[model samples]
Target chain A: MKFSVMVNEGPYNHQASDSAYHFTKAVLQAGHEVFRVFFYHDGVNNGTRLTTPPQDDRNVVARWSELAVEHKVDLVVCVAAAQRRGIADADEAKRNGKNADNIAEGFRISGLGQLIEAGIVSDRLVEFGD
Target chain B: MPTVKKMMYVNRRAPHGTGYALEGLEVVLIGTAFEQEVCMAFIGDGVYQIMQGQDTRAAGMKNFSPTYKALGDYDVTRLYVEQESLSERGLSVDDLMPLTYEDEDDDWAEKPSVQVIVRKELSQIMAAQDVLFNF
Candidate 1:
């Protein structure tokens, strides 16, 4: 089955993102396809290149990046949500003249329409939250 | 047959604390607008979103509990609350808004499909979906 997921929580502050990663891994191992992942609300924080957990703790952001790269999944972060939460890619930072860029690779900044499009295109949409 | 994405939205926080619930409803409405199948489950503090008579305006934010009633307009009728969450918080069905969903005008009450589910077995709901959203 083709899957599309929407993640709405931050990694360190909430387990929603971590659980989502585990669920995605299980689905992939079970021979299912993850079509897309749409990140909104605190989920957009996963795209911030600056999240660094304690070395002793789980590196969830890195894990998500690795999983996304290995699977070639479409990792979409909502632009509106990201902006509201102060997450910015190079283009956004440049446009706003911020000194640094925080959004990492393997994640695309998109609009709510992508979320709607995911609904139209995917066989299912699942939510992971607080 | 073409793949039809069955979407599930997980709500984790309660209403009035943050914008999570309202924002989540927005996504569901948008998802339903595209004619996709959408299901929602509330967990942890998220169960509070469905609680009746939420007032966030005192905090200087928009009062959005009204939006929950509008969900049916986009065909979002399924609203699931975790059994464990309710028990953990000592909440009762009566504490939540009437299971009845209202149309856009609020003139008629459309009873919502509400369920109380175990926490551990949540994966049963999760495993069946093609996509899941977390909020």
Candidate 2:
């Protein structure tokens, strides 16, 4: 079964993103395809490359980046929400005339339409939020 | 096939204190463009979102009660209120704003949108959904 995961809250402050990450991992491990993982609302904060957790703590942002690299999972962050929260990739930063870009590796910034598309195409769309 | 997926929106938060209820409604509104089979269930504190005569003026928040009335115009019907959630909050159908939709198939007759359901039945609705939006 193809599964689409949605995380609606920021990491650490809320366990939403973390729970989504684990669920996505388990889905992949169970031989199920993860259609996409769309980050919306405060969940876009998990895509910032600048976040540096302590040495022992889990790096939520880096874990997602690694998931993208290892599993080739599609990690999408909502562009409108990301813009308001200051998360932009290189292309978006250049287009919007912003000085700095903080989008972590493996995550792409897109519109809410991508989220809708994921729901349309995937068999199951699971959401994690407060 | 009609390509109409079973979609369920499970709301479990209050109207204010956060953007969940408002944004959740916006998602449902946008989702109507797909013409999917969508249903919304109010559980836990989420039932408060339908409380009638909600006055958010004191908190400087936008009163969004009017939008629920407009949902039927957009064909975003099937609003379900959990009986347990309402009873736990000491509320009943009288405390809620009645929502209705026009059935064009049935000569455009008006029909009530909000369906008061028990928690178990609401769970069955949730399990049957292809896409579950929890906000």
Candidate 3:
């Protein structure tokens, strides 16, 4: 089966990001196709590279970035939501005349259309958030 | 193009109070570009999004109520309102805007787009969805 995941809350604030990550890992282990993972609403915060969690805690955003790299999964963050929350890629930063980009590795800034498309094409779309 | 899945937007938050309602709608509106079965369910406090005569000027926010009126143009016509939710909030179907869509398959006939369903029925509809988006 194919699965698409949506994370709607930021890291640490809610268990949503953690739950989504574990669920995604399980899906991959089960030999399911991870079509796409979309970050929307407050979830876009997961795409920022500037977060530095303490050594005692798990780096939620870093974990997701590593997962994307290892599994070759497409991690998409909504551009509109990202812009509102100040999470941007290098190209987005350049386009918007910003000095820096904060988008984490293995995540791409895109429109909500990607989320919709993921829903349409994937066999299952699982949402984790408040 | 891939096979289309039946998608549902499970909206539970009230408008304006949070980013869920407005941002969720933005996704649904853009989703109209895909030829897939998409339906929106207004449950809990989400029913307020369709409430009629909304005046956000005092709140100093841009009123997005008019966008709901344009949903039909994008073929996003099905809006399931939980009947119990409405009553719980001391509201009725009369409190919501009368949204309609032109049925092109039926000679461009106009028909009501909002469908009021009981909790039991709504659950069944939810179970049938291939994809569910909630914010």
Candidate 4:
């Protein structure tokens, strides 16, 4: 089945993000297709390209990027949620006059409408939040 | 025959810790108003939402746990609990908000059509749903 996974929790500081990562891996291993992974609310933090976790610990940002690359999944971060939380891509940073760009590659800053679109096109939509 | 839209909502946060849970509840209410079938699953900290006692005025937030009781009125009846999360928090089935409880069964082959799972299990559970919304 085609799936659209929603990540609504931050990457670190909470188990939610880690859980999201492991779950994504499991889905892929089970031979299912991930149509997209949309980030919203605090989950937008997963898009930070500037994050630098300890080399020893699991680097979540890199993990997500790798997952997207391996599976060719569409990783979209909510534009409104990102800006509100200071997660900006290069274009968004320029538009907003922010000096820094934090959105990691393989993830694009988009809108909630993408989520709605996923609902319409995908067979299943799974959300991980709070 | 009319096909009832069964929407399974999974809530993962405490009642007042953030707005995701409440906003999610609102969506479910709206779904019901639109004649969609809605079921709820509380995993991880979301179990706190259905706890017997909640006081929000102290936080200057509107109290909405009462709205939970109204879910039954909306025809939202199924509420599932993750056995691991409940056991981890030392919570028993009795501590939840007067809902039926289901443990993680070993037989994944005969699992419920849909399930509410913890953070670790979310991806798999989400893949199974026709529509999954996480808050």
Find the candidate with the highest lDDT and give its number. Answer: 3
Task: For candidate 4, state the interface root-mean-square deviation in angstroms to 1 decimal.
Answer: 4.3
Choose the strongest candidate by TM-score: 3
TM-score of each: 0.65, 0.88, 0.95, 0.57
Candidate 2 residue lDDT tens string, A1-130:
9899999998899998889999999999999999999998899999999998999999999999999999999999988788878999999999999999999999999977788778989887888887
Position A31, candidate 3: lDDT: 98
DockQ of predicted candidate 2: 0.53
Separately for all candidates shown, the number of backbone clashes (residues 3 or more apart, or on different chains) is 29, 0, 0, 3
Calculate model 2's interface RMSD in Å. 1.4
What lDDT does candidate 2 reach at residue A12? 91
Against the unseen true structure, what C-alpha lDDT does each candidate score? 0.79, 0.89, 0.91, 0.73
Model 3 chain B: which ten-residue window has the lowest total lDDT? B1-10
Off by over 4 Å in 3: none
* Candidate with better TM-score, 1 vs 2: 2
**Which regions of candidate 2 deviate over 4 angstroms?**
A90-99
Residues B30-109, model 4: lDDT tens digits:
56655545567788888788877777888898898878777655666566667677888998766755532233344323
- Best-to-worst order by lDDT is 3, 2, 1, 4
Clashing pairs in 2: none
Q: Which 10 consecutive residues of model 4 chain A have the lowest summed lDDT?
A: A112-121
CA-based DockQ, model 1 = 0.34
Q: Candidate 1: lDDT of B112?
A: 61
Which ten-residue region of model 2 chain A has the weakest summed lDDT?
A111-120
